[model samples]
Target: MSEHKDLNKLSAAGLLISLGIVYGDIGTSPLYTLRAIFNTVSEGGQTINPMMVLGALSCIIWTLTLQTTIKYVVITLRADNKGEGGIFSLYSLVRKKAKWLVIPAVIGGCAMLADGIITPSITVTTAIEGLQVKFTHMRVIPIVLLIITLLFVIQQFGTSLVGKLFGPIMLLWFATLGILGMAYVVQDLSILKALNPYYAAHLIITNPMALVILGGVFLCTTGAEALYSDLGHCGRNNIRVSWVFVKATLILNYLGQGVWLLQHPHYDLRLNPFFQIVPEPYLLFMVALSTIAAIIASQAMISGSFTLISEAVRLNLWPKVRINYPSNERGQIYVPSINWLLCAGCLLIVLIFKRSVNMEGAYGLAINMTFLATTILVAAYMISKKVPRYAIIIFVAVYGAIEFTFLVGNMTKFFHGGFVTVMIGAVLFSVMWGWYVARRIKSRFVKYVEVEDYFEIISELSEDESVAKYSSQLVYMTNANFKTEIESKIIYSILQKEPKRADIYWLVHVDVVDEPFTQDYKVTFLIPGKLVRIDFKLGFRVEQRVNLLYRKVIEELVKNGEVDIISKYTSLHKHKIAGDFRFILLEKHLSKFSKLSVYERSVMWWYYFVLKKLSLSEEKSFGLDSSYVEIEKVPLIFVSAEDIILNRLPA
Candidate 1:
């Protein structure tokens, strides 16, 4: 079994890596968060009230403190699954406690994936919007689109080289944020009064647009979920320690922006406060640096999307998709289908929204669902750990109200592009929900029989001379968990289909465990040399390359003198040639003769015809060679049609 490295140990490199990977999204939030907040309240170039400024600033401070720092960085990080910390990873830990928990896991997974589309579009566009400060007439759309196209294009070649510079670039970016923010904060130390919670409460009670302001405020902590998702890449302690530095700079920058706002209460809403604070001499350089930072943030989100979908596929929450390892780096992966799809979605968002300000609503709405979902899973996790009842209730009550309020605020943008993200999340959720439920519906009818019932017959079939040899060793992939049992379809394929004869029969089962990197296999020799069953227990994050893994198991078995692979033929055996192995895959299809309710039929239609068509084929998904694999179509009759009347006409 492969062991996970201890990236959690506190060290300089670990902190640097955490800066690059864990903070990309939140680190870049300063790009547009305050801009969106002021724009919401200012309305039609009106003078912005001083209370709005101080209250909004106070809201931003505590939101980051409670939402990002306390809930995620401090508490949720404790729910790590063997050093992994995503909604799915958290769900995997508590799924057995309650089957209903899958609802939140799937919802959270789809919402985060949907967030990937807008994060790139908004961050890059907002950063490039800085160009307008120097060149008022510059067309930002074309430039933003070009940058995004280039970013997605490089995904296939791997980013290890470019990835190495991410830590340093982000480090510089955060430093720039702090410097520019401090330059303004010193001019008006009184703006620091916004840090008081009283201002936040005053705004909520008196401001009519409180919900709208909150929708904007939610953007600051959007990356908190991503912070937790990347837990495995950089351990918990690294994140915790780096977050202190990250949060300090973020607060300083936001405070600086507040001071700038206080100095000019009626400042032009067209200009972003984030860029306005920058000294004119460095505006262009700042714009260029921010664009690069935006790309890094986008890349991290895209890569995280691939990892999320990969885990979903292994856990059977999603249909199998082709996953490619473009680099030798341990966790780096590329999914061509998802990569291109995300690219197209991003381009579409740029074309429709046309400005970073227009995307704020969509971005906030999409990620708010993810925040709520994570809260649910984390609460369930605390419950599983047997935390005190009062603590659990307080945790849920406080964060639940916080996130739900954010959701309501985001909902205000439904007609104004929020629906864009909602619709995307819905489509993604349907696919995941359909895939999971359809599997349950199908599994309910799958037949399993005791393997012991057929051991004697399988042994005899291997020795039957009248039957033609299928292969020296014939293997069948089974879904049965216990070594004492096998899927009935596999038995039907072997004995009833063609009466296949072979020197040996092998049944292989794959069990995806909750751990992230487990890779252990158990081999049970039912009839030593004649019949065998191998169970491969893999972690959710582990790739299921059955062909390669099966071969490795055979090699180990042969080395231990538990099996013989030499050709059984008289001539080939003398030459010591290797035996041939063939794999049988029984593909299932919906049977027309089966009776199904309208809901089941719809789910089956989507799962089989839609999701199944979109997914990789069984042979390719399992990493099996086409030449050595055979697929037999099997009709899946969940409920057979009522006894047909006069079906036989005396034939």
Candidate 2:
């Protein structure tokens, strides 16, 4: 195991960039949380009581402190996967001993993705809703949809362009929050008394409506998962250090709102309380700034969704897709399909809810479920790593009580609007889980062929006059083991139809492992000319660059005197270089069988159909140039037991 490195090596500017990118979603919570809470009360048209306002503000502050600052910033961020963090990162850390926990991990990931969709819709719509304060009749839903549409459109270009500006923009946002908050704080200093935890505890235990209020208050900390998920982008030290300033600003703003509500208890703060704190003359200008800040928050989540999907693909928890890492920087990625899916979801949410306050009912549950899942996974991780069982049990008992309470409080709002987010998460989780299971089953059924089986045939082909004259090696890139049908096609084509002999046949298998770097490469040789199997065990953190690894293997072979180092080109490929290397690609097609159930055959057909359309052919999948590829397709009939024994064997 490699020693963990300190995060101080990254410069201050880099640290700030990391914080800006990672913390944007959470940092922008002040824009709508207070306003949403106020709207919930104001809908009744009754005067807001000073005590209720103060109690709610106190709950918001303590929640951020205990949940976001203490739990996530102090403890959760420490469970990093070589500096990466998320449900998947926690899964990797603990999956060895507690593999059963993967179900909940998948659930958490789906919930996070669902939150990704609704968050941007609510955050941006709320900011735009504030615009109605400046212009009484401005349409909110259309503008919100437009903004979300633009957000998705720009995702394909990647975030590196806009990410550079995130730090400065977020810094201004925090400063704006602090200044506006302090301005209100000066108006009524008495509200500062509500900062005590006793006020929150008193309200929860005494106030009859406190349970529902707790559900609303939980909104303020919805961005905590965003903080944990983005830890890898910004190191743990940078995020932890930055949280001090961010958390301070959040607390002051909530307290300032409390102060304002205490004095203006009967004043109807309709749209957004954060915007209300600024002076009348500056209110319009502040609304404009807040709208821009909200858009940036949405943009941050759009990028986050892309990163999560990319990680899912690498882990094989999701289907294979085109994953492009836009920047050389680790964790910077772009996924076109997911970007569009989120855009569609966000637009639909805005059109349906039409107002941020209505959307608030749907928000807290998804994030709460995410928090609960993380706590469960992290506890399992601590136990797996040899932490004392007693310590783990006690930690779980305390955190479990707190999280379960919040989950139930949030669950009370299920029919109130939580069903939308839950449904979205359920659909996504089903698709991902279904694909994961199908892949595993398909892998088990497919047979792998040994390299030794082809050696004798290849040796015989080498004796042919037509094959001996060709100066190229036949390299096949396949995921199938020795028994895969594609292997037989390569044999038939080379020995029967074309009969081209080559100096070497390289059968390569690339297994994507869940680590930063693979410990060793396993090489198996089946006597001189018959077969050779080389398994490249790559770490999860490592990029799959075929050419680099291929060169290293060749060098090792030469150093071991298996081939002449000076005559490598001729020895491996008969004589010529460059165009002389011919990569033979045998694609397998699974024919339909009546014996299998309709659903199973349909799924198999769909897999093959989708693979043919989206996945690269064997040549491209292997990273070979088009000019070097000689492709061949083979159809394999998979006869089900029912067809062979029951139907075909007549009585």
- Every candidate's lDDT: 0.90, 0.72
Model 2: CA > 4 A from native: 1-11, 42-47, 449-471, 478-501, 516-532, 541-575, 582-651
Q: Tens digit of lDDT per residue, candidate 1, span 1-651?
A: 123346778889988888888888899999999999889778734457677888998999999999999999899988888888788899899899999999999999999989889999999999999999999999999999999999999999998888888998999999989888888889988878888999999998888889988988989998999778999989889899999989989999999998888887888889899998998999999999999999999999998998998999999999899999998898899999999999999999999999999998788788888888888898888988899999999999999999999999999888888999999999999999999999999888788999889988998998888888999999898999888888888899999988989898999899999998889999998998899989999999999999999999999999989999998899999999988999999999887625667888899999987999999998998899989998998888765555555556785
Deviation of model 1 at 114, angstroms = 1.0
Prediction 2 global C-alpha lDDT = 0.72
In the predicted model 1, the residue pairs found to clash are: none
lDDT of 1 at 291: 94
Model 2 is weakest, by summed lDDT over 10 consecutive residues, at 563-572
Best by lDDT: 1
